[model samples]
Target: AGGISEALITTAAGLSVAIPSLMFYRFFRRRVDELVLNMEEESLKLVEVIHGEREPDRTSEAA
Candidate 1:
C-alpha cells in the first residue's frame, strides 16, 4: 500500500512536469500561428507582384 508521502511526491512530480510541458506547448502553438500569418502575408504580396497590382519593395530588389 502506498503511503501519504508517496502520493504527495507523485502529485508534485506530475505537476512539475505537466506545468512546463503545457507552457511550452502553448508557446510553440502561438509561434506556429505567427508563422502561418507571416506566410499568408508574404504569399499575398507575391500574388500582388505577379498580377502587377503592386510594385516589389525597393529593399527586396536591392537584395
Candidate 2:
C-alpha cells in the first residue's frame, strides 16, 4: 500500500513538471517560427530588387 501511494505521488509530480514544460516549448516554437517566416519574406523581397537592377546590365550587353 505504501509503495502504491509513493508511486502515485511521483506520477503526479512528473505530470506537473511535464505539463508546464510542454506549454513553454510550444510557445517558444511558435515565436521562432514567426520570426523565421518574416525573415524569409524580407530576404525574398531583397532578392527581387537585386534581380531587377541586373536587367539594365543585361540589356546593355545585348546592344
Candidate 3:
C-alpha cells in the first residue's frame, strides 16, 4: 500500500513538471513556425523584386 502511494506521488510530481514544459515547448514551436513562414514570405518577395528588375520580360513567366 505504501509503495503504491509513493509511486502515485512520484507520478503526480512528474506530471506537474511535464505538463507545463510540454505547453511551453508547443508555444515556442508555434512561434518559430510563424517566424519561419514570415521570413520565407519576405525572402520570396525580395527574390521576385530582384528577378523582376533583372528581367522585365520574364515577369509574366513568374506567374
Candidate 4:
C-alpha cells in the first residue's frame, strides 16, 4: 500500500474530488451571473427605446 493508511487515501481522494467540483461550480456560477446581467441590460435598453418612442406620442397628445 506504499505505507499509506486508509484515512490518508480517503483524504487525498476527497480533496481531488472537492477541488475540481468547487472550481467548476464557481466557473459556472460566474458565467451564469454574467449572462443574467447581460440579459438585464438588454431588457433595460429595450424598455428605454420603447419609452422613447412613446414620448413623442404623449407630447403630441398633451399639446
**CA lDDT for candidate 4:** 0.82
Winning model by lDDT: 1
- In model 3, the runs with Cα more than 4 Å from the true position are 53-63
Report the number of backbone clashes for model 2.
Answer: 0
In angstroms, the error of model 1 at 27 is 1.3
Candidate 1 local lDDT, residue 45: 92
Q: What tens digits encode model 4's per-residue C-alpha lDDT throughout 1-63?
A: 655788799899999999999999999999999999999976786687688843323432454
Q: How do all models score by TM-score?
A: 0.81, 0.78, 0.79, 0.72
Pick the TM-score winner: 1
Decoy 1 TM-score against native: 0.81
C-alpha positional error of residue 36 in candidate 2 after TM-score superposition, expressed in Å: 0.9
Off by over 4 Å in 2: 53-63
lDDT of each: 0.94, 0.84, 0.86, 0.82
Residue 19 miss distance in model 3 (angstroms): 0.5
Candidates ranked by TM-score, best first?
A: 1, 3, 2, 4
Ordered from best to worst lDDT, the candidate numbers read: 1, 3, 2, 4
lDDT of 1 by residue, 1-63 (tens): 579889999999999999999999999999999999999999999999899999987786654
lDDT of 2 at 38: 95
